[model samples]
Target: MMQQLFTNAKVFTGTGEDDFVSAFRIRDGVFDWVGDAADIDGQDAVDLGGRTVLPGLIDSHTHPALMAGTAAAAECFPPAVTSVDELVDVMRAHAATVTAEDAWILGRGFDDTKFPERRMPTAADLDRVSTDRPVLVWRCDAHSAVCNSKALEVAGITAATPDPVGARFERHSDGSPNGVLTEIAAVGDVAAFIPAPSRDEQIDALIALGDELASRGIVAVCDLLSSRLADPLTTFRAAAERGLRLRVALYPGWDPEQPLADLDDDDREGRIRIAGVKVVLDGAYSNRTAWVHEPYPDSCDHGLRLVADEDVRAAADWARRNGVQLAVHAMGDQALDRVVELFADEEPWLTGIPSVRIEHATIVSDEYVRRLRDARMSFGIATHTVFFFAEYDGYEKALRAEQVPDAYPIARLYAGVEALALSSDRPATAWSGADDVMLSVEAAVRRRTYNGIDFGPAAAITAAQALMLYTGRARMLSPLENVGEITAGFDASFAVLERDVFTVPAEEISEVRVAETWIRGERVFAR
Candidate 1:
């Protein structure tokens, strides 16, 4: 790339100190000079017209591979379809578009908690969409799904079928399958039967999604669980070969039943590389399946701890041998406690990066943070604000009154954890556009849910802190290198905003738009 100078703008360098700069010069896809415009010595520069610039954002934990694979599914997320009736209408409308009578009618992002009925959509409700063709709609968390009667039959699930270990097929009063599948095992049972899109189709979808991500000011992401597709690394690399620009670090899921493929040079080095393996330890909080220290209110259940300690150790061992990070999906306090205990005496990585990362660390306590820090192993956390922002109703019911204060305590985590990233577990979250960086920044600053439920400002963070979490702090958790800052010698990637996020009222942060997104000295997206 040729040398380029961008001037006349307020640049948030994400350096955490004296970060703002007025001008920067890029050469060969890396920043070479960053200082005041007057220091440019009369060099020709493209004036930004006083816009606000930020280092390219990084989403440390997301499922873009899942998003790409399910791009064709009908979107049933809320503020669009907030009722069972509305959900049915969406599936019905989508069904109309499928010319083949036998084609499956699929939908994603339905939150039963946000509905007026405040109940899960039943098989009968989805039957209204298509009694003949199979219909399956996933809950917003992606941990559960409710299918129509046809889908149930197609999956061969029945009253006699035993629930898989660590998963459940919710039943009716008569012991017949109610079409509700919980957790990965149950959801996968029906999902496996759905005809998967071809690899080429998935690559195309991925490239399209990459463009969409760039438009939102995100330049890199960790596909926390990339094995949702047939060949995640290859598929992502294929997309990259066809103009996909996002820097992706893929963590293919760890399954004992189906061992991950051995890594090669291609998998180990690239813009899209296999960073690690992920092992899910428990279910989500939204469905009250997260393994918690205490039972959920009005219930004797302490939720389910899906994986065995031995299995987690095995995953850690694998990661250790491979010299890659091991990401544990620990949503509840009990699960988080298990993580701290399991890795307390474990070996640390020779690499400077954290050896283990706790994903969705939903209910972190002061002691937990202390232990994680004191432990021999290096620890990182990739948590989300969108979870509470979109699924507050589910959390409202799942958490005790005392637990609310500590739930997703942003300020505490920022002050405590050395490696912390506020990410968007998109498509998994209840809200549409969950990956929008501005929305998450507003959530971290305001500490308010989508319905305006106040989680208290005591745990809130400043706008700069929020951006750092998404930028500089977030990059620490991912395998992507030379990103998340506008400092000299770093990748010349950043986003130009329409207004200064620091100057905006905290409540109005989400309204801040990305006017342009540049990557490697090239303007890839312009709004």
Candidate 2:
């Protein structure tokens, strides 16, 4: 059961340009053959001198155990702290190596709209980095957080507590408490008083973030939240008993004390499975709090709806009565018009489930893309055009210039969705190198933003439709069968590339690179 082949590469069989293959064959892990290498006759080949292969990229939304607890936090972002006095001197040099004098320094991406003090960093600016230890930071869209008066007095969050139903806090004018916590029920009530990493440090941060997402050629994901770990199915069965070869699916986050019949005796084969249920529903248009139908142009308000329409119709009636797939996290346009009117006549993909997705459908419109294409809904759109090149200047300062031509439109969702998927909601969009996938396929084929600014260039798209939203339309929203696509019976899983990101130069498609990655057929990663 072990044959190989590969030869003079090029491959890319996400079918286009006459099914581009230069040779292929794997055997043990699938994909058994695919054309020309002078009609193959050799055995165990492996030449690849031309390099290019493809399809072993699939992110479709991520959060590898919340970016592996941000490798012990403290990063504050943007050319490293663009103000508030370099974010209180990098949180007072990460609280002088935290030898626990009242622990909890944390910290994440930052970006108060590219700071320079454009605001947001209160709690009296993290009490100049230590009101006797307990800082926090977060906002590179982990939907906001600031903390520090010893973390709102150890999360008792005063100023007479209150303010919980769907999050708030940022007070201080006469009303007090200004530690700036905003969405996710006020950043999960100050991250439930911080401190949670054991279970062998969450399986050593999920095998070091699954070998840094298999060295960036990301073999598979869809984690969504995986119950922010504390036994996400025993931390993915101890990350596949420690070999952790990527391929995860997990969705877990609806919890009525872990219901859905406690994942009914789960243990879905090696690389992790529990694929269903994660619900946010609103918040994050670079902190203007995306629940938009219009307001935020410097504010009158029209954001923040952090779930509730009878709790997204009771999490779509428990994912259509426990068949699974729910997803949700809608990004604006009034939370994707109330999740396209609660799955406009639910289909739950004809009962095997995986389809009602919509996470970060960041501002879709044209009458909700014609009400999600006239509700023939089997919905799926896990989007994240690397937040259009990392937050298109905070969506041109909180949208409304005609909602900046429908924010992350991706060529009007590949001319109207049929299961789109692409992702990197990484450390909620700032674990640097803009969560690569060729920098979200060069911001979905150059709709540009890291300062060159051309945001919705008529919603540009086409580096083969942005690498089929991260390969073969991101395995049609993940129950991960034949794997993204290198063709012949699929799943030999690949990546190779060191150029030919579709004949280059769409601003050098994030400089291409990723020289080797394979998965089901082995070679985990190479450089």
Candidate 3:
């Protein structure tokens, strides 16, 4: 690689110091130096013409392949399926294009609450689409999956097929399955036919999604991979070996394709460290499956548990012993408690390691927040602050009337000892770049949604603090120390900005583009 120098640009290292520098040079992909142009005059130079520059924004969490994996087809009714009639119309349209050999007709993004009286679709709805072919649609949560009569039969799910622990098989009072599957294990029958793509294709699709992040100024991602998504590390490892412009830290999931439980996080050759093992404790809040401590005001139960206590402890221990950390996805208070209790256990090897990540710290409690700090738990919050936008996309009244908050609790965690850090949980939720940065810290401080609800204002933190969570404290969510900051000795990873966030209006932060982004002194993203 050739040396490169950038000159005449204003810079913000995201450190407390808002130092504007004159030049930067990179040799062999590391920051050789940064300062007066005269210091490196003999080195090759490219003037930036006084543009803004900052370290590349690092995405603490996301699922790259699965975000772009849904096969594109007809109009997806999604949050629009207001009635059985509407779903029927959309299904019929999707079925019209393919032959029986194409096998299943898939429907994604249906929000059950959007329907009149908030009812979910059943196997009967599939009759309107196609009787000979299988049809399966996913709820917006991606936790519960709905199948038609054909799909149900293919799974051999007669009334006799028993539902397993941690999985829900919604059935009729008459004892027949209603064609809904919840938790990853419940959907196994359908996933068998998902048709595996070659590793290269997986890499291409994942890389394509990364480009979307790059356009938004995200230069690196904590790529969360699952059994359904398979061994993305191999593909990403290959890309890094070839010197791709992006950086990724791979985390494994529990699924068929990802039998990584036996493997270690050692990755000197992959160019990507094994971020950790990802575990799920419950389902999405949208589907009402999150294992909450209190019942949703109108509901009778605490919802679901994606994994049992024993399983979580086992996984966390494995992560603790190995070099990798544990990144648990626990939204409900009960789930969070289980994680904290297990994490706080006095295990010799577990001490001194960074707090294991609790992805989507949605719907937390005051007790949970304190416990998290006492136990030293860390989190990668889905701070797109999107929940308040569009009135949480029209589910507000139904959700608020119940008054039991869903999604992770930013305020409590922020007010508690832990505070907050940022993560996009992408494709899992519709993602936004600036909104993520703003929401992580701003939402924590404001606690009011864009829609004007003081959801939990008491938990909000100041703007300056939020920036630290995303930039300075965020790297700790990984292996710790050398990531997400802009100190001189810390790798020159920073984002150049039109305005220093401390001085910019919080409302306008989301709209500001990165003037330039650098990693290890190399220009990874420049606008």
Candidate 4:
């Protein structure tokens, strides 16, 4: 490796607003000096042409394995497929290339809320794509899916088939299946029958996904649901050996009946490692399945609670015994309250980071924030702004008039909690560029949806503060050291930007692009 000095550039170390440096020195993949350009005048330095530089970003919560699996699927996301007719056309085009009569034709990222018809695509709509083969399209949330009639038959779902414990199959007037499967249980029934790709194909997909992430300036990520891939720990390790770009922390989904296999000694420390276990306590607010205290508008039904208290306790116990973090998916207030109550008396992790993380603390009240801080247990939250930015129509129907101001209160949480991160649950989100760090940052700064609806302007934070949610503030989400900063002894990883994000107009923050991305002091991507 070469020792290099980068000079004549604006660098934000991510510590605070005043933490800027004109130059930095990287020696053997770590920062050795980050100070004035005058101090290193004698040494040969690479001039940066006054470009703005930021620490390489960290996406605290994402689903890389799931994204990789669907890389080949037809993208039915908004702006491209805004109606049921458009969705069918995209799937049909994808189906045309597949010659196999028995192969499943797959599509993803269809949001009914954005459709002009305001309705989910039914089996009949998908039947136009193919009747001889299976056809399935996932709603953007990924919690539910709609399949063609042939797929329903393949999954053994019929008029007489009983709904699973926590899932449902939408039916028509005569009790025949409508081809809409709601929640994980119902989605899994059809998903299980879809043939698994070859191990080599899985590895290839992961590597390709890593490259895509690198190009977006993300150097690290926490795959919240690693179990989406078969034996994720081993598979990710193989991808790393084959030169995957990002450093990943895996959190395999926790199951009561089948616990994850014990981690190998080599799996404890490396480019890829198991960070913890994840257990989803409730569904998402977008689909009105978030288990909220109040029922949705004009409906008596509150959303579903997917797991039992005992099951959550079992997962907590597993994390405690193994000395790892336990990330709970609690999107609604009621579900968030349950987590606080259950762990109120527990002690903090000896490592001093959060022992328990509440994923998507979406509708947090001041009382909940106070309780989380005052509790004996150390708590962290991973939330998002993109949910509102991209899925505003869904929220419009789900939240009450009074509850609107409190949803994903970014500014409040930033002040109230020490361990808070704003992350994009990509591929699961409704937008095409859901993983774009700049897009999420812009949403946090502007506090406006894609259609220019302001949730609450007072809840917005500054551009720099929003960036911290993906940088220094986000470091606590993973155990990887020397990350999320440009300080001395930290990893020599950062992204050079075309323009300064801090000085740009509030709405133009998302327009800033990475000119170059470097990992471990080696330039991996350049535009």
Alpha-carbon local distance difference test for all models:
0.89, 0.76, 0.60, 0.87
Name the lDDT of candidate 2: 0.76
Best by lDDT: 1
Candidate closer to the true structure by lDDT (higher is better), 1 or 4: 1
* Candidates 1 and 2 compared by TM-score, better number: 1
Error of 4 at 114 (Å): 0.8
Candidate 1 structure, TM-score to reference: 0.98
Report how far off residue 466 is in candidate 4 (Å). 0.6
| Tens digit per residue, CA lDDT, model 4, 15-40 | 77467898999999999889998888
Tens digits of lDDT, candidate 2, 3-32: 688788777776542357788888897787
- Determine which window of 10 residues in candidate 2 has minimal summed lDDT: 261-270
The Cα error of candidate 4 at residue 290, in Å, is 0.6
* Better structure of 1 and 2 per lDDT: 1
Clashing pairs in 2: none
Per-residue lDDT of model 1, residues 286-379, tens digit only: 9899999889999999988889988888888878877788999999999999998888787797466799999999998788888988899899
TM-score of each: 0.98, 0.35, 0.81, 0.98
- Sort the predicted structures by lDDT, highest score first: 1, 4, 2, 3
Candidate 3 whole-model C-alpha lDDT, 0 to 1: 0.60
lDDT of 4 at 401: 84
Rank by TM-score, highest first. 1, 4, 3, 2
